[model samples]
Target: MAILKQDLSFLKNNVKQVDAEMFTSKIRGIMDSHAPQTSRTVTDRTSSPWFSVESKAVKQARRGTERKWNKSGLEIDKQIYLYHKKQVRGINLTAKREYYNLKFSEVQNSKDFFNLSNELLGKDKNTKLPKSIKSELLPDTFGDFFIEKIEKLRHTLVSDFNHDEDFDDSQSDASTLSTLSPVTNDDVKTTILSAVSKHCDLNPMPIYLLKNC
Candidate 1:
């Protein structure tokens, strides 16, 4: 905040010399210096709701036992590991059944029921057309289809309503806006502040930073 205030003060003093482009560059520089960009990896995978702490603990134990058996190569250790693995599978199945039963019992409406069903069937995944089908010509194809439909509908409507009437112009009056109130600095500032705070790649700085300024 102090850095921003100092930079903004300097900018204010040199405001007359700064053109729109120069001002935008200066603001963008300040923002970049203060808050640099960072990159991260993201995944769409989600953990199962039915996988409780007990299930995780049992799974972890099974893994540990399996590791111990692998190291020792003893019959007893192998049997223990196998027992733990069986227990894990059984616990997971029971937990999943209980989770689904509770969810089903809690469903209060058809929407909720359908949502749950879709979730269970993995039908809730995002639907996207293949990239191969999304060519520049696709938009033209859609436009042509709609246009043909519109033309056919227009012809049908025209044939159905055969009677035509003369245009009415007596009620219409010609009026011109001779003057408009000048937009003040306050109005511009208000408009900028009121706008949605969504950042664009081509923008000089984030809308949040502009609002702060």
Candidate 2:
């Protein structure tokens, strides 16, 4: 799946839209075929067939999940950092950088950045952010919140860039910062699934073609 996504990124970067579509279709097929199967039996966790089916692919798949989580977490942290960086004091900036640096180091050493990412992206456990910074980065839940924020930022940036390029003659060079809307919980889930589908569908064509070539 990670390889499929990487292939998709390559196609996207190379501007091969048609090939990208084919790769995505292939990825969907592969995912559908090899999708993990869960058992309802009480002994399934301990005696599952998957546990014994040792293969290089399985090991890589496990690694891929960790990679995805880390990547998603890092993206969310970047969005949260950017949204509030302006309002953050010099001391806050130093603290924030140190906090993220610590989290990154932890992830490197422990291969677990999920929980820490949640801490940074989630609410303060006391109150919402001050009025100086919009709460666009605040996530309502932990289920894939990191991926959600990244998507929101992606869409917002795309919209802002398009708005600036298309109608710059009429509108002032004002920041679209105020017009930006916060990402809702539902929006996060929806966008995350949408992105997964889109990327999974889009990422495998180049590799498939490269194999043929």
Candidate 3:
């Protein structure tokens, strides 16, 4: 295009038929008016080498390399990414099937509590809980831990009555007939809420407001 323009200008100037600047301006205007528009759009330039690489380089020269842009920005480890994926899916922690029922029993023993806690901790590890989960013994919140403990007790009680090698129907009937100690359950809940008060609570006013208003 530049070569053609140069050739045209030479011929026009030599013949002295038109003013060079005026003729060039008129030709440019005509070409611009008649020409189909370029296929340039914002989306087209998004992946362009000039914008993606060159412009990024210029920006990085002025600022530091972005921690969220290219390879350097998204340098998250595989474990971290997997952990975040689980979190996005709302898999907060894992637990076994019978854990809940056992925790609420009167006959749940200390051994059962340990087993339940271990299983819950294993699940947390599977969920990619941070090292903080291990170091703290109990997690940051007490509600989950306390509930697990209570459930373990219930399981122990049921197991003792149902699964003992010397299990007698008469003895089993007596043990199984026992009800949960409300005091024990309440104490466990209190301990849990004390630890996780900020994360767990209910405002009773909502129900009252709904009923009245």
Q: What is the lDDT of candidate 3?
A: 0.48
lDDT pick, better of 1 and 3: 1
* Better model by lDDT: candidate 2 vs candidate 3: 2
- Compose the digit string of candidate 2's lDDT tens values, residues 133-186: 446634444436778989999999999998877764555675555586789757
Give per-residue CA lDDT, model 3, range 72-128, as digits (tens).
445554444444444433321222223344453644688777665675456443454
Using lDDT, rank the candidates from best to worst: 1, 2, 3
**Candidate number of the best TM-score:** 1
What is the per-residue lDDT of model 1 for residues 108-178, given as tens digits with 9 covering 90 to 100?
Answer: 99989998989888886566555766677788877898999999999988876764345465676978699
lDDT score for residue 17 of model 2: 56
Q: How close is candidate 2 to the true structure, as a TM-score?
A: 0.16
Cα lDDT computed for each candidate against the true fold:
0.86, 0.54, 0.48
Error of 2 at 204 (Å): 78
195 Cα displacement, candidate 1 (Å): 6.0
Candidate 3, residue 118: Cα displacement in angstroms equals: 63
Poorest lDDT segment (10 consecutive residues) of candidate 2: 47-56
Q: What is the TM-score of each candidate against the true structure?
A: 0.44, 0.16, 0.16
TM-score of 1: 0.44
Instruction: Choose the strongest candidate by lDDT.
Output: 1
